[model samples]
Target: MHVYSRRKRKAGVSDRGARVGKIERTTYALGWRIHTVATQGGLPLTYRVRQANVNDEIPTLKLLIEAVRLLHRAGLSIKLLIADAQYYWKDFFKLSRWLGIKPVIPARPQIKKTLINLRVKHGFIVEGDPELIRQYHRG
Candidate 1:
């Protein structure tokens, strides 16, 4: 399962669960953020609703843990996990690796630069195998 965010804007203060927060630079809204975990085919596996101020990563780990547990109980296994760069924190990668899920996320800019530099310092080819490089670049 993978998580994605949806912005739900409220029209009035009577919208009990929504909160006011910046959605983007210089823009603010009263809303709830819907974080959902879904199958690769687009079926929702589970979801969480939180005030708009909540960051995606905060609930993502919890959502993944729950999804993994549910899948395990059904005798299923997750092969790969695909998520946006927002979910590219090192701890998340480590946890997914520990759980045997191949993460298919593109590194954030700073991390990408660090990885490139590390590869160069280690004398490893930056784009060694054409096909493998292609797949990595796909994310």
Candidate 2:
């Protein structure tokens, strides 16, 4: 069977552009995106790859649509898809549901209300390290 492949790439400065701590790389970074399809019985069928300096949401949606089209032609259309939350957006859910495919993705933790409200609702819970001296003093 003939399989199709597509590629896209994006480049940008790394958040940690050359420094210590969380920012440790003072350099450019390239992000990648890859999508693949296999038979209903789990056999390798086709694949594509794309890279982007930005986010994966839009690219992933585009690639998924193309893959669905190809799979339909091959009689192996996708049904249930498991993916990361990075690709979880309103449009992604809309398109996949429209295609009759169920997507299982965890909600992004950053959007958790309890976590977001911690500092504001009740001052941050700052815990101080316990030193051996403190334990000895208590004893």
Candidate 3:
């Protein structure tokens, strides 16, 4: 499981003339971090664990590469990778492509914005673009 971050409001003493107290903002962080890869049958083949302070993308990429190597040695090759947005990045996608593995990852908020811009530039709806749709769906 992955940890999610959320913003919270805290009560604080009022500083201005208003009767309502100031709202202090607080953010919560996940306590543990873990990345895993498994076979299509749901048999875990790789595991990477780190502290909460570690970023998810880097370790996940490393773990994937290692899994690929292990599978290759065992006369097996992966065809697809499924991951969350936290582990999604351009480099990861490129690496997966180079290794002949299709990656299925959700676009980050910024990536979604970029896609919107691309759609406008081409003057075509995303649904009408076969290649774009394939990439978006398969990637």
Candidate 4:
């Protein structure tokens, strides 16, 4: 699940239950955050909507599990998962590994640096080849 925001700029909008949240410094919006799970082909599989103030990670595990179950029933296998930095957490990584899915998310900057340093100290490859990394990012 990845989170995306939509602006609700109209005043006195009714019944949509949009909430006001700060999206950046000196900017605020009334809207919802969309959590979407999509295929590598850019086809949307499932989605959930929640208030903008809600955290993206909250629904991620549940969404992944749901997608896995649905795919399994249809005889499909989940081979790789590509997501943005917002989904880069240790638990998320563990979950994907446990499910036999290769997670292709770039870690947050500090985490990335730490990981690279550790890899160098342990004599492991710091990063994949540029072409392979680029392909994953494109997805």
Best by lDDT: 4
How much is 13 displaced in model 2, in angstroms?
A: 18
Q: For residues 1-139, could you state the per-residue lDDT of candidate 2 as single tens digits? A: 2122222336543533222211113733333334554444556455554443434564567767777888789786787655544465668878888999865543454544321111111232212223422321232
Write down the RMSD of all candidates, one decimal each: 6.8, 15.5, 10.3, 6.0
Can you write out model 3's per-residue Cα lDDT over 110-139, one digit (the tens) per residue? 454432222322332344245545555443
Candidate 4 lDDT tens digits, 39-106: 88878777788887777778888888888888899999789887765587788878888889887775
Cα lDDT tens digits for candidate 1, 10-120: 633355656776666597777777788788877878789888878887888888888898899999977777665567677887878888987766554445443111121
Q: For residue 58, what is the lDDT in candidate 4?
A: 87
Local lDDT at 125 for model 4: 31
Q: Report the lDDT of model 3 for residue 136.
A: 51
- Our tally of clashes for model 3 stands at 0
lDDT of 2: 0.48
Estimate the TM-score of every prediction.
0.69, 0.49, 0.59, 0.73
Location of the lowest summed lDDT over 10 successive residues in candidate 3? 15-24
Task: Determine which window of 10 residues in candidate 2 has minimal summed lDDT.
Answer: 115-124
Provide backbone clash counts, one per model. Answer: 0, 9, 0, 0
User: Which window of 10 residues has the lowest lDDT sum in candidate 4?
Assistant: 115-124
